[model samples]
Target chain A: MIVLSSVSKWYPNGARPALIDVSVEIGAGEFVFLVGPSGSGKSTLLRLLLREERATSGQVVVAGRDVARIADRRVPQLRRIVGCVFQDFRLLPNRTVAANVAFALDVVGRPRHVVRSVVPEVLELVGLGEKADRYPDELSGGEQQRVAIARAFVGRPRVLLADEPTGNLDPATSIEIMSLLDAVHRAGTTVIMATHNASLVDAMRRRVLELGDGALIRDEADGRYDQTVPQPLSPSATLPPVVPPPLVMLPPAVPAPRGVPAPTALPARPAGQAPDAERSPWATPTRSGPVG
Target chain B: MGDTDAQWPGRLMRPGPLASLLWTGLRRNLAMTGAVIVTVTICLAMLGAGLLLRAQVHTIDGFLLDQIEVVVDLSDGITPAERSALEAEMRRDPLIAGVRYETKKQVYERFRRDFRGSPDVVAGVGPEDLPAALRLTLADPRASRDIAVTYTGLDGVEAVRDQRALLDPLYRFLDAFTVGAFTLAAVQALASFALIYTMIRISAHARRRETAIMKLVGASNATIRAPFVLESAVAGLAGGLLVAGVLVAAKVFLVDGKFARQTMFPLFGWAAVWESAVVVLAAGVLAAAVMASIALRRHLRV
Candidate 1:
């Protein structure tokens, strides 16, 4: 399980904050999607989960430990437990597919006997078992990404974070890659994906969290992909338009930390409905009767 | 990881990252390796020459000292019995290796033999004013000063002389030649070390990418450098052995030539060359080992 409270992040020497006043939680075996536009703090949120950046305030707990307080030397252990697949697909170009995966095992000083068995099994898991002897240049982009994912999941990390795993693949190949992530998630790995693909998110029917201007604006259960200018919601609709999955509902609608919109205490919206367009984009989905 | 250097001697011998990386560098740069082998071979050849010359000079000095004779002329008041007794006392001294009596007549005959074919100016009269002498050999040449000091004023002696002074100038020249050879060998050895280090450094620079990758992959620095150090060391030792063999063979075949019998050139025998070769080869191996070990220390980073 991962937990964060009052986690605000900022880049070094940058005036604008990347993420402000974010408090959220993700339970074990939960698939959470962090969705935002190009500059929305999606990658920064993922980077926080990976401890690539420390919180400016408060604490971050990942896999039952306070990751924010851990030493830099022990960070690799955290990385070992939390598998990260980067966009660039960092694999040694000179090695074969098998060798590339074997490198991961080798870095942690796995025995040769163990490496012999684990390499082929993980390759098979990613459907690259037969292409083990081929070099990276011989494989297509999809295959190479599969190899990267295989490398990430070889040790079966507790949390899997894939950032843009299918940014360059075709639609079908993207579906295939998402299926692989789903398989890994089903095997009890908590998967957090940051992507712009709506069809994959809608088809999977997973929870989604949307960010705007580096703040948690709309978080919904069984959410839909709409070009919704986020406004207020009332008690009229039968099925409310669900926001993204697993949002720790927004706080007061004030200036939130990290440039996020502070959510005020408000009434919950109904399901399978449209987003209210009359209120400001930063307002909550519904307004309660009065202020406290 | 904290205190590896505090370990025992056996642990010290284990290949460190620096040595291992040097080993790889040595293997990758075969041209430099070939150059090292040739340079070491030349060095070993020069060392062997110096050794053989030193040994040959020592043996010739030994032969010359053996021929050096001490002359003791009796005073006017001394009798034949006193002279005989004095000779016996000198022979009984444990420091003497051997002593041979020579009358004035024998000295003249020996001089004629040494200076044969010299013209006597239209007459057959041979110059015969050579000294009466007792040829002496000491267990140690250093004791000659003591023997000369003790025997100078004894009875039955006109004059007791240690004539090794005549050979002093020749000895000094030989000493200079030996010193020059020793200096040359040392200087050349230093040059060889610098040459080998530069060669290994160039090799490392050429293949630095391979080493960096290995380091990132968690290979220890020792595993990377072992090949280069071993390669250069083997080449150096091989060169030493080769030069040693060549010198020994040359001594056996060339020194037995007819010109060696005509006399001025003091060619060394095979045994002399063999003994000297062993010493030279030892020196060469030591030099190579030092160069190999040092090259690794300076170059291997990963």
Candidate 2:
């Protein structure tokens, strides 16, 4: 789970804040899309979640620990729990496919036996098991991105962050990559992807959060690609409310074995009920009046 | 996944992931490896040469000091008591290594033996013509001037002479040469460090993609840094060993076998060469490691 409360970020010497009083909450096991135009703060939001940059005010929490309070030495522990993928598919050109996947495990000091077993499993998952000996340059663009995904998933992290995973791909390849991410999400990893592809976002029909000028303009359930007139609240029409159980919803919040507190539990409500309007003040109040 | 997780990397002295990374880095940056090795080798060789020259100068200084001494001649009509007093004072001096008193007859005999090559010259010199003298050897040859001044106007002394002035020009030349060699070596060592720093920066730039990947995959800062440091250190070690081989060869084949026999001044032995080689080897490894670390701290933040 990821939570940001009134988070604001301003770079030094910049005329304005990159992110302005942004508050968000994402539950576990849900795939969400972060859509924005160029320089509209999509990358800055992701960077803040990764703790690459600190929030100027308020709390930034991931998995239950307030990241702003995490010490520098413990930053690696947080990073190991979170997996990231880049737009350019950053793979070592000199290493083979198997070596690339194995590197993730090796650096964390996993046992040799574990690394030996995990590399082939992840490669096979990505359907590149036979090309384990081929260097990255030898592979096509789709295959290289697949390798990057395989590396990100090798450690079985709870959260995956992808920054424009298909920005450089053709339409067909982009569909294939999105399907792979969908498959990963189905298997219980919370996936958050940021992109500028409108058609893909429209086709996915997942939860969409739009940003313009560093503000959260719209957050929709089964949302679409483009913004339209805000639909009036249907007092009788309820939101889609199949909130998957929180990662640690077994009623024991004191495990502390995961090195942090158990994730904040989702609102306990029956299906087909309206989302707590009080918690989503921006979603309700802005729809009732002009959005600044 | 507790302490064992942290300890896993600490035991990586063998061919684990970090070791393989180091090997791969060395293989990929072949040109950089060669440059670092060559620079380190030149630096160490110059340093070793300076050390060898310093050793030779010390040996030559020892030989020259052994041959220089002070001689005090007695005046006419000197009493035996005064002569005995002078001999006792010279012998009691802490600075004097040894003192020998020669009578007029013994001096004449020594003169006859020294002039045997020219019998006519020996016949021309009588026993009365030779003055009785006291020859004093000082512990330090550089103190000869002080001794000469102290004894020149003594009650029973005719004159005091120092033979060390004849060797002044040779000592001056050796001192200048030793200082020059060390200065050159120091300059070359600094140049080698600059070259190593540049090489590390280039190598890091070339591998930026891999470094970014590593960081995304959650590799620690130490893990990212180990390969560069290890590669540079290995290059320095190889360079040091190469210079050691050159030093040993020069000592065994050139200096000991040829120069020592011709000049009759002993050159450095195998022990000295090996000692200098060890020192150079340590210096090379230390310098490379330090240079690589500094460059990485500045350039390779990930």
Candidate 3:
């Protein structure tokens, strides 16, 4: 769960703020699509949630903790609960697929047995169990993204943020990657994916939060990619219909494996209830009411 | 979940994975690692050699300073009373440690024995040709110049000579040599630090993707930096061991086997060698580790 009340981020020498007066809330077990053009603050919003960049003025709370105000030393602790994937599929070229996945756990100081046991299971979950010994260069683009997903999901994080994860893949490969993400979402991890793929966004029919020129333009439940573009004559007429692959069914609600500290699940906030301002000591006090 | 949370500190305490990471990093960058080790070894060798040479110079200085004395030669027409009075005067002087009088025959005989290899030169000299003098040893060798200047135009004195004057030029040359050695060592140390910095920067650049992934996966800054720092530390340790080997070999071969046997001057012993080696080792390791840390901090932000 995340809450951003009046979040505004500005680059020091920039002429305009990257994000301005944007406020949004995401509840637990929700899959949200962040749709925007380049420089529209989609990636910037995700970065704010990760605390990679501080909001100039805001209370960016993730799972009941104000991420912007957490100590620098505890940033890693926050990251352990919120995993991330990127468009480039940032895997170490020299490491094997299994080592690459295990690296995520290793950096968090997981024990050898846990890495040994959990890496294979996660790789299996991503359908890369047969290519465990293959290097990143040896894998196909979709497979590489699957490795990245397995690594992000291996930590059993509560929230997964992806920034254009399928940008580098073919349309068909992108669909497979989306299916993998859909399975991850089905397993109870909150997924906030930022993407430009209208077809996938339309096919998925999930909640859409659109940004334009650093402002939150729309928040729609079960929304299309764009309201301006006319809908197709038929839902599946313009492009190939997006569908989950038949073989890649992620085990439903996979429990936390040994050695990974299971994320403390926060209770989903009820609609119309105000966010608790007392928990965020560093938040600006100018606005107190919930954003409509 | 609570049990796993309680185990976090204990699990992090085990450096087993980190140690492997360090080893793998070193192995992956073998050429750079070897280059760093060689650089450190050469620099530390120069530093250790300079220190040992300074120690040897100090030892020889002490030995030679203790032998310093002033000689007062008597005039040809001086009476025995004049010679005895001059001897008594020197004995009573606070600066004079001891006074021995040599007669003309004794002086001539000693000159003959010193030039025994050159019989032709000895044949030209006679007992009456040499001057009788009082060899005046000083309480402090540094006072030789003052004593020589004091007795230069005294009664019954033909000329006064200070042995310290003869050795001053040699001491100056040795002092300059010591300073030159240390300066060269310092330059080499600077070069070593620069090489280490460059090596760490290159390694960090090469592993930037891996490091970025590590950071994304919640690795601490220390965790990301540990392998690079440990790689440099391993090279430093190797270089220090090589320096110790070089110093020990220098002591055994150059100091004891060659200089001690070939020259009458006293050379420093093993204790000095070990002390210099330890200092060089510490300096080499400390510099390498510090340079690596600085390079990582500047070039790689975890």
Candidate 4:
């Protein structure tokens, strides 16, 4: 289970907050869609859910632990419990599909015996059991996404959040991917996906939340993706923290070099001199020895 | 899954956690790792060669310092009895090794022999013009005071000059060069480390997509870094082993070989080259491992 209460996020340079006083809950075996338009904090919320971004204020609890209180060192453990499918799929192009799936186990120091049995099993679950030997580059988009999904579910993580997973897939391929996710949700995995695709979300009829300019604008039990018109409440009410100076750019200046003369002298003071003269060309400067 | 596939990679590679990391990492960066191994081997070979050459030079330097005799010059016309007494006195000094007298004629003969094949003007010098001298070898060069007190006022000598003055400076220069070789080797070793680090970083960055996936999948830090560090260390090992072999071969066929034996000063311990290579290998590999560890910290960030 994942829970957020009064969560707010503000970026260092952002004009407005990414998340503003948002609260939500996701339970086990539930298929939820975090639907929003562009710049609507869907990605930010996802990042916050993964604890990749910390909330400026409020609590984020996932899988029986307050993830907001987790130190950076212990974040990996939190990540292990919550498998994430990135929008870009982030497949390691260097590893074979089987090795990529096995990587999840390898990092936690699972023995080779467990890896050999598990890697193929997960690949089969993702429908790439036969293509385990292929590299990420050798696979198609849907195939690569499947590899990513396979990698995430290989550990049987309690929670899964996929960001824009079906955004790049065709209509037919999108349904196929959704079915796999639905299958995972049925098997007791709490799944949350953020996507702009309306047909897929409407077809699933799951719980949905809508965001606009970082605010939780709507919540519906069986919501369909729709274009929500913006209503600017008070654009100029908040004062700007710092005003920018007008630009009048100029070219950079170049500096000139100073010429220095070279110093020339023989190696050992030409072989004979007083006892307190320079001894060697490289010798340190102290009047204790002579060179001739 | 078959049992052999499960156990074979582990057994064949003889991998602990680190070895398994190394094996998997090498597989990932196979080309760069291969290149690093070759490069490290060559660099280590050069370092070993320089070290072995320097070792031989040190042995010869020691021998040279032991042999050059200090010449004591007293006022002319010493009697035979005084000379015998001086020899006996010097023999009693702890620093004195041996003493020999050179009469005017002996000096003339030695000069004639040394310059025998010189141009015509040098060959006609007479024995009467030569000065009588005493040749003294000391157990320690710094024990120059033995001659300072014993031969300074003795008859038939004018000046007592330390012969080591000429050769000591030469040895000092050689010593500096040997130190320079070590410094140069250290710098090159550092460069090799940087090269390995850069290779790992580039390879890691290029395959960062995979690494991110690996991280999300719950891979351990050691499992990810082991392969790259192993690849870097392999460079050092290759360098060490090659250098060791080169030194041993040079010793057998070059140093203790015919020309070296026939030379004015013979070099001892021809086997030291290969032995030294083992040390070089250890040092280089250790250095490479350190570099990889530091680089991995930055590159393997979750």
Winning candidate number (DockQ): 3
lDDT for B174 (candidate 3): 74
The reply for model 4, stretches above 4 Å from the true place, is: A25-31, A56-59, A64-73, A92-96, A127-143, A203-205, A219-292, B1-46, B61-166, B169-173, B186-194, B293-301
lDDT per residue, candidate 4, B1-302, as tens digits?
Answer: 00111111221112554465566566766677776776676656656756775777667656755776778764557677877777777788777788888888888788888787884745567777667877888787666655666677666557778766666665576667767667767677666766787777766755455455555555545555666777777767776777677777777787767657586765757456656876787877887788889888876675
**Candidate 3 chain A least-lDDT 10 residues:** A231-240
Expressed as tens digits, the lDDT of each residue in B1-302 for candidate 1 is 01111111221113343454455455666677777777788777877777776777777667655665555555646677986787799889887778777776776677777667774631364434455666667776646777887788786666767776666776687678777777776777877898779866765555444443333333334444555566667778778888888886776566665537766645666777778778767766777767866887787654
How close to the true structure is residue B150 of candidate 3, measured as C-alpha lDDT? 79
Poorest stretch of ten by lDDT in candidate 3 chain B: B1-10
DockQ, all candidates in order: 0.04, 0.17, 0.20, 0.11
lDDT of 2 at B275: 84
Give the true-contact fraction for every prediction, in order: 0.00, 0.29, 0.42, 0.24
TM-score of chain A of 4: 0.76
Per-prediction backbone clash count: 41, 0, 0, 19
- What ranking emerges by lDDT with the best candidate at the front? 3, 2, 4, 1
- Residues B195-257, candidate 2: write the lDDT tens digits: 778878777766666666666666777777778888888988999999999999889888977
- lDDT tens digits, residue span B1-302, model 3: 11122125422413776777777778867888998898888888878878987887778657766776687888888888988888888888899999988888888888999899999999998889888988888887778888988788888999998878887876687778778778877887788778878878767765666777777878877788878887888888899899899899988888788878887778898789889989988887788888899888787776
**What TM-score did chain B of candidate 4 earn?**
0.68
- Model 2 docking grade: incorrect
The sequence of per-residue lDDT tens digits that candidate 4 reaches over residues A162-249 is: 9888877888888888888887787678888999889998888777766766655555556667623322211111113242110001
Top lDDT hit? 3
Q: Model 3 segments beyond 4 Å from truth?
A: A12-15, A63-65, A70-74, A170-176, A182-188, A198-205, A227-292, B1-7, B10-39, B62-165
lDDT of 1 at A292: 10
